[model samples]
Target: MISKNTIDQVFETARVEEVLGDFVQLKKSGSNYKGLSPFTDERSPSFMVSPVKQIWKDFSSGKGGNVVAFLMEHEHFTYPEAIKYLAKKYNIEIEETEQSSEQKQQEDERESMYLVSEFASKYFQNTLLKTEQGKAIGLSYFRERGFTDETIKKFQLGYCLDEWDAFTSEALRKGYKLEFLEKTGLSIVKGEKQFDRFKGRVMFPIHSMSGRVLGFGGRILTNDKKAAKYLNSPESEIYHKSKVLYGIFYAKQAIAKEDNCYLVEGYTDVIQMHQSGIENVVSSSGTALTSEQIRLISRLTKNITVLFDGDAAGMRASIRGIDLILEQGMNVKVCVFPDGEDPDSFARKNSQADLQEYLLENAKDFIEFKASLLFEDAKNDPVKRANLIQDMVSSISKIPNQIQQEVYIQECSRIMDISENVLFSTLSQILAREGKTSGVQPKKAPAMEVVRSPEAVKTKVDELFELERKIISLLMLYGTAEEEFEDMVLKENDKGELVMEPEIQKAKVFEKIFLDLQEDEVAFTNERFRELYSRIISLLNEEGEVNIEKFINGLDPELSSEVTTLLMEEEQYRLHEWERMNIMVKTKETTIARLVGETILALRRFLISQKIDDLSRKIKESSEEDTKESMEDIMDYLSLKKVLSNKLNRVM
Candidate 1:
């Protein structure tokens, strides 16, 4: 476990804007930075990062958090991973407290595999630069591929020696267990023998979005006909090939900045493009495209331009990935290289400006590319032409956005010399048949009307959530600020009966919140909210002043994310911006008394209204013998609700 001092040091040293800017393109908007959400696809920016508050909120996805939470959410990293990442980024030396032997044994297996993979990557790279055979084979192969020394080191290109047990023996000698080596697919073991998996192959280390080495892809340098040309790490707890794109870690920022991604086929394709000054590129790593991969790109941008080789296989590649991109509501454009040249050779052969210009001029929409490619074989045969039309329609049907589909349909009609109505009719038939076979009803064509839910009915339960959120937000922002609180106290009068009297006292914001909620006997309906409420009260009791940073660090990442959202949701203007604009927005500090009373009263009213409704329902459903008592309770509840509503000046 990371020590508290180290976590605090990391938080104090790490700048949220600088850290997130590496992943998303942020432009200045008012006092905050705004950008398209990295969590969801949005053309207009709704993601806001507040430097003052040290938090980010993505209005599109309802995800908001501090720096650590953002890393956890965006990269799917564990708590330790996020901390370690921030520590490394900010140059903070992480200090870990010693754990017991049993606690040490409980460390995650995935982390163990990661450690082993990282060690092996360093070992391989060292071998390539320092060893004779590795220098002679792996370094020579990479140099022949036109990879410069800087590019080679940037990609962490390496080599695994040809000997069967060379890496395995070295790893074991270093006290790294064979169990982890085999698990990371750096070494393979059988009964009494062990061998390296990528013997004599130049290595390409594949990284996760946060730059951890998840796996490796190695290309065999030997001319042995029996040997496989390329080898990849087997799927393990840390690596899933389908979900990872090769150069995403390096290209994420460029992709967001360009608002488009250039898709290519191999690791070299991505490396070459990056080298040639087109940094916004990622590769499928020579694997068939999957929706998971498409979704990954969608987070950064909604436009994907596939760069295809001029060969026949490239045509098939473009066709296979086009529908998938369209299904995700992303625009797909294809740029074909000149005859017989691939992205690798083409990028190397042309100047950066020339290559970029060629891409811009030659790129065609998927419909145009598809139509032109298929027309070659289908032109003279009516049957083949019909099949080609159906093929185009089938791809068009996969599109979820109606407007995009219509645009593509018109483009297809023009290219194929078919009428729009004919294409639409075929598309309609295909959608109907597929819907029926898939046990779904096809949406009614073009004439669909929007339906709105009824507005006449209102739920008190719904209003309570807003009130609950407001109360929590205030507590998080101003919980330690001092306040004078007034409350009604029950006391005995001159007579035997008890009467209510006013009591005034000075207390902290947290005290007022706890006492107000306690007096009302209200409980939070949301589990996370209730958890935060309890934690705040406990911390206040244990410590005098509530340190927001420490409190945030103590909560789980998910709960901390929620707390951040509540804290940042309503803050649109910073103090400096407001002053500059000559706009005086009321803050809790100046209006603490009124704000506190109103929030408490609002929550009381919501809870009372809910109770009154429940009693009313119970009275109607109760047996005759119990109806009178239930009705009496309902009347009392309604009377209290009316009083609370009047105090809040809310309509009953």
Candidate 2:
């Protein structure tokens, strides 16, 4: 277990905006920052981060939390993992109590697989750097490829020995389980024998965005026609090729800095591009581009430039990925290298400036590039040409943004020498076909149903608005003020006659609001809201002043988002500074007291109105036998109405 002191230090040192900014692109909005929701697919900004509060919230998804909570949600990390991540990011030294071997053995299967993968990575690195054959083979290969020793170490490049079962024996001897080794695809087991899966191959460790080794890619050095030249770890609980992008863990910062990502095909393509000074490039490792992978890049940036080899097959495959990228709302550009030269070779021949300039001059939008490439083949055959047009229209239809689709459609029409009307008709047909097959009904009815009766909802909404405003007033102003109030009580005299007596008591408005909430048996609509209210009340009671900044900082993201949202929303009515000065507006303390009192009264009135309506219904339905019960309910309702009326009059 990590010490509480260390956890506190991590939280104190790690800034929420700085940490989340690595993954999310934030633009300042008033006192907070807004960005596209990372948790959901949307173009508009709805995710908010409050620097003052040190927390974030995705209003669309209702996921909010502090820095630790954000990591837990965003990365799917455990509590300890989140703490460790923050610790590492902030360069805090962590001291944890060591777990016993038996206790450690009780870890869950997923964690065990992670441990096994990590251990495999370290063992491979050790073999490559420590052993004679590994040095001559793996290190030499990397050096030949122009990978600096620092780069090699940074990427953890390693090699496996040629001897069968070399890795398997070492892992088994180190207490790692064979089941996990096989599960992670590090070891292959057949009949009664087991051997390393990537024996004699240089290892490329593929990592998740958080830098956990999810799997590996191995390259064979020998010229065995029967053996595959390149192999990847099979899909496991921790690794999915379609969902994982190689080099994202290392390239995220660069991608964010440049606001663009360079997409390549193979493992070496990524390494070579990085070594050649293009640090923002990543690879699909020759797998088909997937929506999941596009989204991973989309989270970092919306612009991607695909680097393709000049071969015909490579061009066709590269074209296939463009539509998927567009579907994820990303802007894609294609750059085809010289014939027979891939990204690795092409990048090696040019400086960063020249290579970047080449990409810029050659990069073409997907619609323009695809239409130009396919236009030649379709020139003689009108039917093929129409089919190509349909294919372009299909790609355009997948784009989520209507404006983007329209622009692409116009571009396609102009380039293909087709009329805008004809292309639009084709787009319409494609959309109609998709709608029918996918069962996507029109959204008109659902939108209409959301309309509510203005008059009926206005009263409730106004009541809530008034209450919220009053609460804010108290929170901001009279959170520390004490006031003297008269309390009425009944007492028996010596003659046993009941006498009304008045007692004076000193009480703070913050205390009054807290007690009133408890007395009314009312609860907040949300748990986080309730917790924050309770905590604020506790702070006010103990210190006489509530530090809004400090309170917000301590809250988890969800509560922090709610509190920030409440605090930052502009009031409908604003008193000008000069006008307020002339009138000598109520002191902060008095204003808070009045606001709290008025809010309670407004809520009481709303509740009383509801009760009156319920009692009226009961009175109409009651029979003679239930007359007494109905009468008692009616009296109670009348009493509540009187109290509400009195409170409302004071507030008004």
Candidate 3:
């Protein structure tokens, strides 16, 4: 086990937004950072990381915590592993006795593999930037491709030497396990011998969204006829070729910001476009684009523009990705470069403005682009033209949205010079055929339960439960905030009669809540709330304020999860930012004092009502002797009720 001192230091030093930004593309939102949830498929951003609070909340998936929790949940790090990862990241020295075995690959195979891949990426990069062989080969290749020194460093581009075992031997000397070396496919192991997988090639490290190196795509600098020009890391535990995009780690923010994604076919294409200031772009990693790959972009934007080579073979090879994009209901546009040109060449030859203009001008809807490509030689031939029309409709039919399908059908009709009805009939035929083969009918939505007011259906226990929840939320959110509270005091006036009056007093939120609840002798009804209530109170009293981060870190997973959930409930409403639209919306932060007082007033009123009801029932069940005492109790309770209503009026 790691020392508590180390864990505490990690938590205090690790910035939530900074740490999460590596894995999730985060943009500033007022005081917090917001991004799309990496856990689920979504178009809008629902994940929030608060740097001040030092916690994260993914409202979409409802999984959140401090920095370590994010690593544990996303990276699948064990508790000790998470701490060590942080320690390494922050350059904190872990006590040797606790972390002696941490370097072994056998302890956690997946994480060890990740560490090795990361180390390999750095090794290759060092060789490229520092070594004579790598500088002559890899640096020359990137520079010739119009990549600047800054661009090279930003992408962490590197090169591995041609000599076999160079990378493997260095990794072994550094104490990286050979098992992870082979598992990540960075090295080719044969019994007692090991060789570098990417030797003699310019390296393009394929990164996970969080910026961990999953694998590499190395381009051969020499024209060796016996070797594949482009070699990719073999499918490994961390790197799945079909699921990774070359520049996604860098392009994610721009994609979300521009609300458009430009999909390319290779690493150089992505790097060149990004160098040309086209930041909202990524590569399919030189493979046929998959739905999984498309879904990754869909999380950022529902609009994709695929840049294909101008050659007929290149166009034909990439034609199917459009259908897959359409199937995901994304608005896809195809931009084929001029003859003898691709994104890499065009980006190199033209200025940024010219490239941007060319892309904007050439981009066509899927139907128009498909028609132009498929009808290249078939336009004058009636039989082939009709077949090509069928192909066009087939792609359109893949669109899941009926409205988008109809729009594309209209375009197909216009471009193919066919009747709209004819295209619609053909699309219907394709969809109907697919539906029949699909064989899964959509299930109807389950009936929604009718909601009634609490007055009509709630028991006293339920009401108390809700009130208790509010108390917890208030304490958790604003316990240390100082505010002026109106304490309603019942006292004897000059007329010697007991009368209720308001006493204005300033108090910390926790003190106000603590005194009121203690005054009323109110106990929490729910077990979790009861525990949290006492714990929060104790922390406030003992520490003079709640250390939310420390308190949450000390909690068990269940309670910590509960605290995160409660804290993030308001984030859903905050995302709307209705005040920007002049809606005059009030935030809880502005009215916390009133909020605390009202919650307590409501709790007091409910308890008083319950007491009056209990007394009335007893009066009915008992004799005249009991009725006298019950009537006086009811009168006093009514007076108390009147005082509560007045207090509520002031608080409201």
Best by lDDT: 3
Give lDDT tens digits, candidate 2, residues 313-365. Answer: 66875687888888788988888888889999988888999988998899988
- Candidate 3 on 17-67: residue-level lDDT in tens? 877888899988888888888777788889888877778888977888888
- The TM-score between candidate 1 and the true structure equals 0.67
- Model 3, clash count? 1
By lDDT: ranked, best first: 3, 1, 2
Q: How close is candidate 3 to the true structure, as a TM-score?
A: 0.64
Model 1 pairs whose backbones collide: none
- Whole-structure CA lDDT of model 1: 0.83
For 1-652, candidate 1 gives per-residue lDDT tens digits of: 8998998898888878998998789988767898888866778777888887788888878888888888876765667788899999878897878988767655556678888888889999999999999899989988888889999899999999989888889989989888888888889889999999998888999998778899999998778999878778999878899999999988886787577999998999999889999998999887889999999998888999999898976578558788888888888899999888999999999999999999999999887888778889999999999999999888888888777777778888888998887888788888888782222223345876887678955655667777777777888788888877766454567885444466788888888988878876778997887887888778778986567665766677688788877776665445135667788777667887668878887777677677777877887788987988887777766766666566667787
* Best TM-score among the predictions, by candidate number: 1
Using TM-score, rank the candidates from best to worst. Answer: 1, 2, 3
Question: Which 10-residue window in model 1 sums to the lowest lDDT?
Answer: 436-445
- Is 1 or 3 the stronger prediction by TM-score? 1
Quote the lDDT for 17 in model 1.
92
Residue 490 CA error for candidate 3 (Å)?
A: 16
Q: Give the clashing pairs for model 3.
A: 23-210
